[model samples]
Target: MSNSDSSTTKTNGDQFARKGMSNGHASGMGHATVEIQDGKTVVMDDGRKPPLAIVLKFVDVKHTVAIESRFSWSAKRPFQFKRQSAMEKEILHGITGSVMPGEVLAIMGPSGSGKTTFLNLMGGRALRGMSGNITYNDIKYNKALKRRMGFVTQDDVLFPNLTVRETLMYAALLRLPNSLTRSQKIKRAEDAIIELGLERCRDTVIGGPFLRGISGGERKRVSIGHEILTDPSLLFLDEPTSGLDSTTALRIIQVIKNIAQAGRTVLTTIHQPSSRLFYMFDKLILLSEGHPVYFGKANGAMDYYASIGLKPLIAMNPADFLLDIASGNVNDVSIPQELDKSALPNGNDEAIQPPAKDVREYLVNTFNQELAPQERAKLFALESTREELKLAISEKRLWSITWTQQFSILFIRGLKERRHEFLSWLRFVQCIAISLIVGCLWWRSKIQTEAQLSDQAGLVFFIAIFWGMFPLFTAIFTFPLERAMLAKERASDLYRLSAYFMARTLGDLPLDLVMPCIFILIVYFMTNLRVTAAAFFLTTLTVFLDVVTSQGLGFLIGAVMMDVKKATTLASIVMLAFMLTAGFFVQHIPVWMKWLKYVSFNYYVYKLLIKVQYSDGEVYDCGTGCQSVGTSPSFHGIQLGGGGMEAWALLLMVAIYRILAYIALRRMKTGG
Candidate 1:
């Protein structure tokens, strides 16, 4: 830890920045460069409004991850693979840094050097087992700070169906403060679209693995657009250029530079960047084994190491040199005589170099003794004026709109995104194919005899049960698939959970019923169940009710499990029980299980469907004489159906089950 870079440390190479950037690999970028400028003049805050100048400081930030061991050690055995034990391992050891407005800080490290952990801790996303003090403008992290910050995660968690413009517009509506008018929010979104250079793909859909849409670079830009819609004072991103090409990554870093130039304090983690990309950052923090090797001006990193007698044999990318140092791949570099001898590893053999672990420790110890205290004291001694303090504590309204407006916005957004899924050709074909098969098998049954009546009953049973399971499986994936996006949006306080849930359920209601309506319309006429208009409409209503109730059950299970395999397994078990007690295959349920049938919504819907098409006076021809179908053993010898009561039961379940599902989601931990 040379720790040569301090808050006031200035590299002696500023005059040569242009000369250096114009040579070698940097020349390939042409005129596009990320050069730090002596910033423009800025005014201090008045008491009326928050300060545009924001400085974020993180002090002694340490994170220890609680790992559950797959194997346990106990008195019974030396090691047991079947048992588990609790263990703690600190992934981040007192990571410290600060960023001022108009500056971009890049955190570079080896794969497991806690780059992302440090970013999250500084961003307040990973809260558990973290001990640290993070402040904005010298105030501790609070709701005001939270509302003023934006985070773009490594993997872009975006809705594949939404266009880039719609994505930014919705973010604008949801994240901007309520003080802004609708026109103002729209203007802000438009500015973001223009600023992020997404004008060409503004209408492009953000496609997923199965879909082809925008290019990777555009997707990353759209992510940045989402965060900057509110013009947050601080922006933190996790590996914005992870998978892009060299040109694209440079463009992204340029965009981040532009953002920082706009007075937003920006911090990002880089996965091994090229020299041109490395030169873009104003500040840099190099980590190895969760220890800070260097934190200061990015341009001065090489000079700092050179002062400590560690220099590359040949000219190399500053980022690569730092990574080589972090990885202990420095055989080509010259080591200081004092460090080589006085800070030697515990070994008699001096010809061989020390291991990477020992090198990391040596750097850590050096930083602790020589520089950590000064930096720590300097960071701890920061103080702000009364106006700046008020500006830091000032909080904007988190939700931009009223509850009703939020629901309406989410409703329309959901509708636009879900239209293609529900109305796709594959879904149409599935519904049409199943309905046609059922219709043809019971074609024109005409119920004049007991045999035809029996076929009618079978058709009702098939359609009712099939639609029940269909909506359930479809709805079950809603929360699980969207868990990531939901968490991300909710963490930013985009909308209330109630508004989101209501929009999700009610918004999908119209789309969900469209296919079912088409299916029932085709099959009902073909099967010739009942010719009366009232009976036909009533039958459609019953199926719709059954579909809705089953969907609610799926929501419950999905919310509780939140995993596809586990939720599917539980759904299967539950539906199996409902079917057995439905009195379809078995007339008399076990006495011990008699109470179970009342809980299954299928029990009531089955009888109601029969009553909708069949009447009490209706009789079927017997070999000996005529007999009442309603009283016959084939009908389970139970009262076939009653009006109003069974539908009420289904309606009640719809409300209760969905309410419980929403409650479950509320309990879920969405990181901030």
Candidate 2:
């Protein structure tokens, strides 16, 4: 046999062996060999009984999407004031197409061609100012249909710290139906890993900029594996192979093609594919400046172009050729005077010039007048035949799991992810270093003299500031960095917003407590602020509350900003403002700015710490004299709000800020 045939035979044999091993037949029956010849399973005539074959079953449902739209989407401004000056950009201009079952439709276009926008609109990711009918199997797109569809965005948007298996397992737990047992959900995740050829990296971490982990191709497969774990009837992938090497890109596309062949509708936006990769698409949707230039079979695209007197150069990749045409690179192409331009909208006239139109406009006008009718007829025929098949829509449930279950899963996953960073050796060392520095700064502070008392008061205020500022700044990056992942998951309706917010808040509590406890233990005894254990415990409690409150503020800022740099900038400015009014830097505030203290978390933290340390009413010796602790000389001009009240205020701020964070997350979900 030739080498190619021999390699194929070996591959098949390995697959059978692995299957038998997985089915628990290999160990019991010793060694067995199986093969397929002429589409028939053949077993060797050995004395051993043939091992039972293992067959994996996938959801065989088919979904057809027919979408027609004239839509416009607005760009989101960083500041609301800029929105008034921003203009609405038209994306889709009355484009129409249908994706049938057992077919892979590739949407192709140049930069700013609205290819991704069109796909987002059909996937129900965009709903604003969209005027059109999008139907699945002749029914209007609804929550039920959305639940049955899976959308894979261009960016992977996964937790870099989590392993491949953990990521897919969490996705399965969240997206799969509640009727499925836990073992079945786990089996689904395993099957997805196998299907995506990710068995090797199943336990490898999905690395990001901070850490080295799996290869880019493996990460892409894991992303695909997450979406396919649910086995949705309709799958949408946006730029699935945009950044991979040519070989990896081809492999990814081949997997998608196999998915289509297994009776699912696959729609994807592909850019600048190779000739081999381009041919894998069963149908093509050519878009330019939000208009359809061509919608037909992938192989017939070249013929259609030649019919319009625009043949590509010999041996050119078809995708590259189509992109050139869409980008208006074709020269000397004449626009037919008889072509109908009246059907096109007048609003986008600026996008296309009059008299002699650009290449994209020419193709769009021609397709609408000549080819679209034929495509529409095919969709209509499919619609008419829908009655022949019994199509059952699964009953839609908003959440696949209960609230307690969601919180439990999310807590475990969040804890596992944060444990890698929150308690890292770097963070531990940093905290220890900060503690030693603070200890040495106020080494063995005493209450013997007024200057010493003032020094001790400064130390206490610094402690409050450190705890408040450190955790807040560190936690500010949390939500902004995960915004994309959160948006995608929320769009999928995986869990309730409250469940995620609570789990995230509660998961970080342990780490938040750990750092503050270490800081206080090292600093409190070294400074000798109070000798009593009760006093030290109260001081620690005060600092811990400050940390929690600061973390809550961070969550609010991160959720509201949704951009790491922007949120960090805002947090810095806000923290600086709080510190300035925190009763240490400025003793007597201006009457006009007195209101700043009420909103400042650091102000309350400082007050609570002072109360915990000085509430004993002890006496201190000034440089030249002695004074009572509650006197102005000992306590500095700081107002002694009762420690109990200050602690309650800190707790209230935590609740308020977290509530606001949840609201911001919800607003992000609704596109408010």
State every prediction's TM-score relative to the real structure. 0.89, 0.82
- lDDT of every predicted structure (CA atoms): 0.78, 0.73
The candidate 2 region of ten consecutive residues with least summed lDDT is: 52-61
Q: Best candidate, TM-score-wise?
A: 1
Model 1, range 147-241, lDDT digits (tens) per residue? 77789999999999999888888888887767888887877677666555567888889999998889998898888878876657788999999
For model 2 the local lDDT of residue 632 reads 51
- Misplaced by over 4 Å in model 1 are 1-51, 69-84, 338-352, 392-397
Please give, for residues 293-372, the per-residue lDDT of candidate 2 as tens digits.
88889999988888876776466778888898788765333233433332244675532322324556678878888888
- Clashing pairs for predicted structure model 2, backbone only: 450-622
TM-score of 1: 0.89
Per-residue error at 352 for model 1, in Å? Answer: 4.2
By lDDT, the best candidate is: 1
